[model samples]
Target chain A: MAGSNHTPIKPVHRARLDNIAVVLHRPHFPENIGAVARACKNMGIFHLIVVDPLDCDLTRILKMATHASEDVVANMEVYDDLAEALGPFNYIVGTTARRGSQRRTVMNPREVARELIPISQNNRIALLFGPENRGLANRELKLCHTLVTIPTSEFASLNLAQAVMIMLYEIFTASAEFPPDFVPRLASSFELEAMYDHLSRTLAKIHFINPENPEYWMMNIRRFFSRMQLRARDVKIIRGICRQIEWYCEERVERLLREAGVNRVDPEGDCEDRFFGGE
Target chain B: MAGSNHTPIKPVHRARLDNIAVVLHRPHFPENIGAVARACKNMGIFHLIVVDPLDCDLTRILKMATHASEDVVANMEVYDDLAEALGPFNYIVGTTARRGSQRRTVMNPREVARELIPISQNNRIALLFGPENRGLANRELKLCHTLVTIPTSEFASLNLAQAVMIMLYEIFTASAEFPPDFVPRLASSFELEAMYDHLSRTLAKIHFINPENPEYWMMNIRRFFSRMQLRARDVKIIRGICRQIEWYCEERVERLLREAGVNRVDPEGDCEDRFFGGE
Candidate 1:
């Protein structure tokens, strides 16, 4: 009976296959575009939107696509500005090849997915991909609600179609949850704000952060850590680091006085005695 | 009563975190290496090991690390070969950034995590992160039993840290599960394989694929499809497309014969007669 109970899991796999859009920006090669279309098809992602795509024949790329996925190439919409094109979607994330000083906050695809998928179910979801030559511009990324970068080696950027396939794959994998055991445990938006507070408070205590004009510092730190989709313990560990730093700093003044007076310290005795009681 | 029975989740979210090690074979950038450390720490991942990293220095790069995650940079390990370092682990995933021409099968991070996390809990897990310049060379990836890549955009390539964080996050997320009602459904491995086979065979039959000397065509198709990670119904729809193509092809041949003088009358009455006699 138990053996029979393990039914074939087809429906479980079909969750969230639709209601998703893959938008490409300024792709140069037609073949790569075709390949991405094919990849989308292969993955059950039919919505393909190309923003400022190069002047290339869809048929040529479609030729490269598998018969099943060619539909993606056949029915792709083209737009000029990414900001204007991706406006309808409730959630949008950009893919970056490397880290930028300005937009340092980047989260794993799974984390991005966990955060976005719930909202996607209710509203249209769009994932904007940049060019074959240069990735999404800083301006384009700013319009996005979130930013995600695939981890890779420093040199040798992945080819266009290949990049599309990878992100599509990540979306597929991150979205698929096993009903019996795998529940989504992503930090909600409010929790994210709380974590940000913890990070800022800790940074303030250390004096590493300027309280008066901490302009981009907090935003940058917030970008990186927030992108991490941190749980509560992660916040706690970060808080501990701040607490430990402050604790060490306060002890440092007493230790400096003891050392200046050439006081010999006891190894087996009190650490406080060495600092405050002239060693 | 059900609501009252629910208990608060404790903050010790350490079980899913692995002693993950990034074994790079000759990294080029000090920044990329630093970024990898940042990526690890951001995801609440702390272990980092580099094998023969090129032109390395942790002091200069640790500034890029945001918090206690800098410890990952501080405690980085450098090794000569993989086996010497990897002898301590049971689960291993090698990152492959370079596109493969020979049809090498690479699992996306989700599947790799599903396979690795359970085994790692029983043993120390070592994830292989290749050089920042050329990804895991094929030889390096061969050392790993399983190969994985982070999915990016169509023309996208990623830095080493991004890939590591994605993999680690997936593995970490899989282990952080709740009870029965929480998990969403995902397609099983068997269904994914079946879908792959069906898509491949159907594509072959269509004129879309060259019947002669089908070199990397099938492979490219498979590679693209493999990235899709299709759900069961997604596969079913694809299979349905294949069946429609077969049906259309049969009808098309019959119409061509009528034009060329084989049938002339254009048989149309009985469905069974139309099917068999169309030949």
Candidate 2:
């Protein structure tokens, strides 16, 4: 296969570090925030988003961040809500030290970085970190499509800044080369949440799932669908099916009432209240 | 090729992180020393040597190092001279943020880490870091056998502790034994087919798909689920939903039939044959 005339072709697309936004959720320390900025700049990731920081003292953050990363700190976006902060990102990777049955499908930083190469080219990616003390809670983790755990020794506790540094380091290193496979743009977290909400309501109406504990049952459905890495079109297709189910159920109910010659005061209102209320 | 008896042999030798020593030369702050200690402990590197630190305030260092890393601080070695501090080390890897003609042969942290793994097994390796303000000078870098430079953006400056963290992280990750990626077994073709058949029948009953073109509509669903590589448990969940839909539709029809009191021969039979005939 080795021919003297052979010339290596350059990859058309490479991992876009610019597309990556480092999201720090509820960081307790301003110093860590500054250090995280420094780490972000060092790794060529410019976008930094801080969600509900306990302390937003510029002096303390700048002291650790140094002057080089001032631009990152200056350009940083602050948000009060994690959901709104993650709304624009197409893919979110949550960092966690603790592993559980719910977070079984975790990838190490290196593995995730490699997997993200193709995805970063087409979709905006978010590297989410929880507060310094406790990591991303289960509720917060629900928003993340993928989970990343940094492998460590028995002494597994890593400083918030250190965790950010290692993760960015892996991504920066991996971004040097391009993989052949290309992942197309996936549905944004906003779109996906909307689809899931609609699906939950539809499934609940059909009595396919218990509305009292929808999230419990919905978690499995979320995992199954997340595995598909649904695009915007896929979300639309699923929502379409949910709509059809709603329509079919209501039409069948109306037809049954009409065929019975029941003198119900308002058949449409009764069925609408039961199935399509609060829409 | 058909041999059934083959036993895998474990490697006889592996990298020993214990043989590595982190040497900080003329570090400016005690907090960085403490943070470096923490980084070292996090990655399983125990030996730490500080040569002529600007201030060796134990309290300030410990404050940053935290209680988890007290042992590392307790056992840390302090020296007045850099040469004396690195006397016992056989191989030295100097970390520098600046590049010069003399240090042209610089390897990124990841590359250097891989190279050090084998050497770390038999020889004492020293990872040298200079002051926070200025990196290892030419005179100091002369003592190092290899030079490592953490790749950075235009803002190449990295905190002293952060630099130490990245270097140690690379070495720790390179030395660790990683198994192949964990991929849980997927649902067998038979299980997937059964779930698909159930789903097709359910969708047809709901009028979500035309009965005449059920296969055409299901092709899209099949492709979506195929991407997920559904596990056996996931397949079961989908089938359960199908069964629930069938039950809900039959129950609703029977309730409507009873409420209207129109003499339909058998409501259950009518709905069952229409929605759940094959099953």
Candidate 3:
């Protein structure tokens, strides 16, 4: 079945993920909603449902979602009732910390993940989340076939996004499905140093850094960047933003000087002096 | 070594716990600090370090802590530098989502827990949690002998408490040392149902539940109670509170009716009409 000179591409197990939906019931915060979307996108689960959400502002949700997971956010469905939202799913799992007589059986996330993986192949599965203040109501939870608790301490109140991420992580890991590796040719130490040096000088020229004590700020910036695990492309993108800012500052400073009727001092020359000369 | 008629209680492996400390670097919220304390107490790790914390309000921390883990909150130590905070510990395990050049080896929490369990027998161990806004700085991470990344999605920003709980969970479960079981003679279904019935009627007598649409409110309360996994003692306490509320409302209604120069209608009679009557 090979082509003339090329091997055929093997298809991934897309069906494993095709049937999973994450449902958030009465989520109060837009940021948590957005973070959930980002997490869903990360684990290759796309379908998202928000039942009677407190806020439906796209801009606010997009703020925490960043630009990467817009597709997940855009395709999200909202419903006024929890039962109506789960109508399409054949298997439903509700998340909760509390346990009661009615709750059939409670399984940790790992066990639930293993159970769901096989069922997910033939049926649509819905993972339900409740609001931040309280977890899934019994009326809402009565709809689910299973309950999964993220083994927690006596104080088991987890933040909403944290709960979403943990459940999705278990499900994704149990399926043994992974997104493509993120190794995109990371920036060399020398390259990263150069970027920081350039950024520091640009900030100094813009007076964003106080000339008197720039070392502390520069050190903090270096420390922050080092922990980011930035790739080569990320460094380049950051540098591009810095360069644009420098360019804006150079022209803006010159205009302000001219408007004030002061003699034009070379912006580039002054920047070089503050950057190389001071150092 | 038996003393008196009671069998002597055996001491647990407290030495393994003695050397361990959980350090929070530049924590911003008091509630998170409280939560970290609660998690530490739950896992039987008591030593806590806060390097340059933003807030140090004991009252606020205790508010979220619910009075159980107060010793942890009271005895927490604070320092200005991460290195100083970790000076007492010989084995430092830093928690981070981000990977860096200097992070010796990135192990998942479970792996880290297993590795640390043996070392903890002889050496002082510190598990570091970073600020909520940004995680541990590269400089702080460089001091760690090992790194733990709680398996997370690509958007791997977990809430401060969730990360702590997950790590402590791994370690606690790995150690096979459990705190006492939280399930303390859970109330039977019939007992819980009786408590809810009494509570609903009390709330109705107090006019807390709207007379117009009481079913929706009662259903919601029932749902809330079911999730609580109420213990027998918990049910008794709740019933007592409901009884008090009913007495207060009955006395207040009689006084109000007398002042209004209206014939006193039987409050319990009216309550029966509203509680059992409405239903």
Best by lDDT: 2
lDDT of 3 by residue, B21-47 (tens): 889999998877887787777667788
What CA RMSD would you report for each candidate? 31.9, 4.8, 28.2
Give the per-residue lDDT of model 2 (tens digit) for B199-220: 9988887766667678987887
What does DockQ give for each predicted structure? 0.01, 0.42, 0.04
Q: For each prediction, how big is the interface RMSD? A: 40.5, 6.4, 29.9
Error of 3 at B134 (Å): 5.7
Residue range B29-98, candidate 1, lDDT tens digits: 6756775676666555667877776778666466445454567787888887777878887667777755
lDDT of 1 at B61: 62
The whole-model C-alpha lDDT of candidate 2 against the native structure comes to: 0.82
> Higher DockQ: candidate 1 or 2?
2
Q: Where is the poorest 10-residue window by lDDT in model 2 chain A?
A: A270-279
Model 1 residue runs over 4 Å out of place are A1-279, B1-16, B98-105, B152-156, B178-279
Candidate closer to the true structure by DockQ (higher is better), 2 or 3: 2
Say which docking band candidate 2 falls in: acceptable
Across A59-113, the per-residue lDDT of candidate 2 in tens digits comes to 9999988888999999999999999999999999999988665645888898888
* lDDT (tens digit, per residue) of candidate 3 on A177-263: 443232234454445556777877655654445456766556534533432444456566556545544443344344444444545
lDDT of 1 by residue, A1-279 (tens): 676679754433322647788998898877667767766765568898988777668577665564656567778888887766775664567777666544344665556666555544545567778886678876566545577765443232445555565566666655534433232343443444555566566454333344444433465455434334343444444444344333433333223323344232321121111100000
lDDT of every predicted structure (CA atoms)? 0.57, 0.82, 0.68
